[model samples]
Target: MIFLIYGTDKDKSHEFLERLMARFLKGKNFFSLHRLDEESFSESVFNGLLKTDSLFLNKNLVVAKRLFQNFAAADYILSNLEILGSSGNVFVFWEEKIKDDFLKKIKKYAEVKKFDSAARPDFKKKKEDEELFKVADLVALRKKQEAWFLYQRIIMKGGPCEEVFWKILWQMKVLGLIKRGGGRKLHPFVLAKAKRAAGLFQEKELDGFLGELVQIYHDYRNGTADLAVGLERFILRV
Candidate 1:
């Protein structure tokens, strides 16, 4: 059998792959596993295994992650979908994203599962959180008036200053990550935006802003700075 587990919710898709493996291995006397990732996957390895049966095991479980990113590997796999689906071995494939045209062809022979980022539990932001996110985004774009206006609107609506502070902190951290993190953990769109914002400021300038925000947080803790007001001032300066 062939299984395709993929989408922007990579973490969830990977978890699904793990669960399938676990269920397949449980109560089994003998089993074989072959795992492929972007860095190490080869068409030769896949072809060799595809043509053979497990020596002592009932079946071979092949797990491939982001293998389709390699055009050659993807082409080979796509070309052989028929036999791969009918083989005694099991193949579980994972990808961050895939094209619909190719997916339709795979569906004929594989069990397809998708995990959309919007459907992910962790990606479900509250309405307030979206407002805060917009505020943070405006800050990234260096639009003082828009950022300040939204910040005030949030406050008027009973949104907490602490939430504002934390969101800005997180955005700043994302900017920093763009500078040095490569940030594979972040969603691609978020990373791309941060990267676009990175060129707007010098590294030293970003570092200074982080230093100042931390000091503001400390001052808030010490009752010397009102967080809401301080963030407003900070917004103007950044």
Candidate 2:
């Protein structure tokens, strides 16, 4: 059997591949499983493996990761799709993305699946993010103690620091713009929040805080600071 799994949602796609392996392993005759990730990947190696047979096993499983990153290797695999798909050996491809044209051609021989991270966010995730947005609102309200406590609690619960930082930055920017009378076109709920948040800070204070955020980002990129640490400090200082 041949499987083609590629997607922008890497974690989800990876979990799907793991499920495939588990499902295939449920049978008694399944022998060995081989994986080719980018670090150990080569077209020649893959081709040789495909031609080799297991001495004592009914079938071997081959999993290829990120092969599409190498154009020549990807083309070689696609060109031999029929042989690979029809062989007794099981083949699987896991990629983050692939050319649309090549995908069309490979669809004839492989069972293809895609999970697009760029698509609309999942509803459950949206609700969780809404909770974080309220945290951002607390920051805008200058409720420092409450925001800091919630931030730590959320991080402890596995919320992403980068997401939290960006959310707060976005809310602050919106509030700053509304304070300057640019929020007339915003949604009623959004405008109301912006206006209320804007009242908590002077224009100069907002600008200074934004600059501090920029510096924090620069420090992280230069390896002098960690994002989570910097974000915590930012919330505490605010």
Candidate 3:
């Protein structure tokens, strides 16, 4: 059996992989597992699936994460799906996202599962907190828009105040709109604008904003950050 698991939630994705690992570990004598990631893909990728004990006892587990950085690797894997299937290989794959056409071809030989970022467990919770985050995010987004308008206004009017610029910057910081630059540098306003457009400022309030931002930057960078419904209550309380 072949499995294709691709999703934005890395935590849950790893959890699912762990569960699968547990199943194989139970009958240790029945299975032999091989795992690969981007670093090791080039070395052992073309070797295909390796046989375990014997046909009846040959349960194979192949797990790959972030295996394809370019179309070359993806094409290589796609081309070999049939060969793996013919060998009765059980493959498990995980990626952030895969192209529709690639997924279609993999589905023909594997039990394909698409795990969307929105479907992760406890992903949607605390309506009040979510609403608060949304408000914060909205305020941050507006400040960004306002900053652009102000920049244009300054250029047209031929002078802008340090105070006005600082005010916009402060607003962005408080609303968790700005991204800190490497070392002590500040992120460019334009870069901040792009990030806001990409829905990166979904966490609004002070506490939630910091927590979510850290979680996003580190733990679940691949996942989506949507404003939760509970944010409304938090906004009212604020």
Candidate 4:
């Protein structure tokens, strides 16, 4: 059997991986766990998959993260899916996203399951969910502080607005503070922070803050506007 778990949401992906490990490998301290790097991943996975179990166990489980860096590794794994089932060895592959071609090949011989982290519901309303969110948020904030300092340093050294915006976006993306797609909305804390920063703006101006930020992003991307100006406008009129 083969399982492919993937999603853009890291938290959910990690949670799913942990749950699967607990379910399958519980109380089995003899099971081997390997963390493979990009350079050695292909070799590690190949060897791990092909190894014979001596414990008389019915199944050998291999869990790999970010398995394939190139088509060759992916092709190798895809071709061996049938062998996995025949040998009673299960390969569990986890990643953020899989290419369509790779996914198709894997599905040919393996039972494929996808877990999307982004599809999860809002965590703020549930007690367990809220605690998880808070923990994640606190870690993110600490990381953001480091990036924020670096950004300020770069800006002081005459970095361009586009550069700053890119840095900011990267940080926000890491923090999961930015939403994607149409229905995606800003976090309450983010909105509150923005509103507080834009204390100079009137009540009427506040209504257009998000829309203007979107416009600013579009304009900046198209090279028609300066990111610094847009950011200043945003901070001044939030």
TM-score of 3: 0.47
Error of 4 at 81 (Å): 1.5
Give the Cα-based TM-score of candidate 2 against the true structure.
0.51
Worst 10 residues of 4 by lDDT: 174-183
lDDT of 1 at 140: 86
Name model 3 segments beyond 4 Å from true: 43-45, 51-59, 119-184, 187-238
Best by lDDT: 1
**Local distance difference test values of all predictions, in order:** 0.82, 0.80, 0.53, 0.53
* Stretches of model 4 off by over 4 angstroms after superposition: 28-30, 55-59, 117-238
Q: How much lDDT does candidate 3 score? A: 0.53
Q: Give the higher-lDDT candidate: 1 or 4.
A: 1
Global local distance difference test of model 1? 0.82
Point out where model 2 deviates above 4 Å. 54-58, 118-238
Tens-place lDDT digits, model 3, residues 1-238: 6677887664456567667767765754466677766656663544635434256775677777777655666777888888767665566778878888888898898876655545324643444234333333444555435334444444343232222323333444544433332212435664555364435444444446445334433322232231221222222333
Give the alpha carbon lDDT tens digit for every residue of 148-213 in model 2: 888888778666566788888988788778777797888999898888879878988888898888
Clashing pairs in 1: none
| Stretches > 4 Å off in candidate 1 | 54-58, 119-238
